[model samples]
Target: MSQRNRDAKRSAREALRAQRERDRARAKRKRTLTVAAGVVVVLGAAAGIGVAVADHGSSGGSDSAGRVIAPKGAIGKDSLVIPVGAADAPSTLTIYEDFRCPACDAFEKTFTPTIHSLEDSGAMRTEYHLVTLIDGNLGGSGSLNAANAAACAQDQDKFRPYHDVLYSNQPDEQDDKFADSTTLLTLAGKVPGLKTPAFTACVTGGTHKPWVKKSNDAFNAAGFNSTPTVLLNGKNIYSNASLTPDSLRQMVQAANKGKKPGTVTTAPSPS
Candidate 1:
């Protein structure tokens, strides 16, 4: 009874120990799987949140007003050109300017009356090409923002007045105040019946930002490196550094000598 009983007892003890070890291993595996699943769930949620934020950022923010800013007639290069006066005027006066440019402000302040006079008298037509060179060169959104707002103004047939007002109230080049849509809308109030909800939405939502970008691209493609570039009858009038408002009128008169009023003229090549 001694040796046989002792061996059987030892075998039973070893089997029980082995079974307990196997159970412990299974429990450890289960816990590891549960922790791994939790980690995956957490990572998935974090990735989803990251994607949502990225989408919001890329969408240029939400437009609460939901107003559509449509383009007016006579869209020129990049659909940003706002023409004034008779569309078929005898001579064509083209102006390339950036809202943040000081020289452009000076030019506009000095020559705006003369240009409008010619336009009102049906002597010559004008084309305004808005550019965002400041935004590209200075690393801010001012030029683009102003140009976009101006384009929006064009939608309401207020481009000419809005354009003049922008130049009149242009901020210092480094200020970047035009980056705020509220400032643009405030300036729009200068023009009669221009401060509407649609215009506000357009300015605030950057509705014409893509058009502004395209206009900028067109300016670059035209080989212009600076602002306040003026052309008359397809020639660079600003090239004559001594040109004045009076001289500009005389030049237009000369260019319109043979051509009749409301006569369409070809656009000049960039100098």
Candidate 2:
């Protein structure tokens, strides 16, 4: 009857769904590795992830999987957070997402404008905790590879646009095309000046693969079992069925009610 009760129920339902997904992942991992010719993993049924086509894989470029190379300016514990927005912003939005996550893409598409506006205005800061949920759940390296490439972009201070580009071109949940260095590099062309020698080497060498693994491990340890676990000011708002961009804005606005917005300058947007 109450909003709090409704939110609680929604959280319960989400938790149950996440548990089922985790169970399915465990079963999938236990099955002997089998690659049937022409057997493509479909998304409509598995987790209801219907999205655009692209690649998702980890096999192509993984020479640096053994090394933990955090991207430029990575902060927080173990250097796992790729932060956006001003450091002194009045509010903080923590997002744990996977590059291969359909839900995450949908969320980004729906909320990016509002989030960006808040960030640009210095009302909030976003900490992106990249994870490989789909890769672990569905058997691919797309999530990790894409996250690494995004990290590489961060090296050039281009993580924001490059991040949007990857989601804009997210592959089928089952497709491992994102694992190919060529595919990743090609996508880099979408972001201006992102395709450079250092960026290329970072993607091809999987320089941030180890860091991704560490972050994923942290995700598991934190009792989170799904992609796109979003928390605003330590409150889990994603589970609220009534959550929307406007409502999010209201919350942030209220949080920053009498506070002065930060003065950090945002990077130029991509064309």
Candidate 3:
């Protein structure tokens, strides 16, 4: 790769590290708030519960509520994994993210291009696991709503670009702007052919909400407390400060050193 590409790669890795640091701080803050809020509730009454658990469960998460309508081509048990890239790729990149997470936005902004490049080359396949940490943390349905919308996109073979679009236009963590179905539908206009009646209905009706909730439930049960928990070939790489897009590429190359590249699937993924 060129120098500029190398620089971009370094930047992506740095962003990942930075996001991890933020995740840790946020986790600590959550713990602190939980303890503090309890005391405040004992003394302040109404104000404490309102502030601590405001808008909780506003999103229709189907953890135990509705039918789990897994999207087209979803893999893994319970159809929880939304996969991209060639199915037979020698390496796998598993990512857990929330649409309303700043850490997730940072990761997508800096690392998506590299990931896309690798996917395009059939060097690796990516499995996306959507979670809703921000919904519980920040008290809104944006995480769940946006995740459902993404799942709907997957049904139309428009997930990769739509996924990128969601991150590119992510709302503030506290805003919950994405909780509105109109906003999600409007964003779909950016992706060609993704604004059809079915897509609109999916977003407006929260068609995949149950699946989103189930996926999140799995995330919580799996012991991952943070969004954007990235793993490369079953190994946690997000916490490795030395990791970079270049090194990741090298790892893929090494993994496929003596193997044939996976054939690209025929499914349409515009952009």
What are the RMSD figures for all models against the true structure? 29.6, 10.4, 4.6
Clashing pairs in 2: 54-171, 55-177, 55-178, 56-175, 56-176, 56-177, 56-178, 57-176, 57-179
Better of 1 and 3 by lDDT: 3
Model 1 — which ten-residue stretch has the worst lDDT? 50-59
The runs of at least 3 residues in candidate 3 whose Cα sits more than 4 Å from the true structure, single-residue gaps closed, are 1-66, 266-271
Q: For residues 147-251, what per-residue lDDT tens digits would candidate 3 score against the true structure?
A: 999999999899998898888899777799999989988889888899999998888877788788889889878888776888989988876545566777888
Candidate 2 global lDDT:
0.79
lDDT tens digits, residue span 152-178, model 1: 888887888888888878888789999
Alpha-carbon shift of residue 40 in model 2 (angstroms): 31
Reference-based lDDT, each prediction? 0.71, 0.79, 0.82
Better of 1 and 3 by TM-score: 3
- Cα error of candidate 2 at position 156, Å: 0.8
Clashing pairs in 3: none
Query: Evaluated with TM-score, which candidate comes out highest?
Result: 3
Superposition TM-score, candidate 1 onto the true structure: 0.70
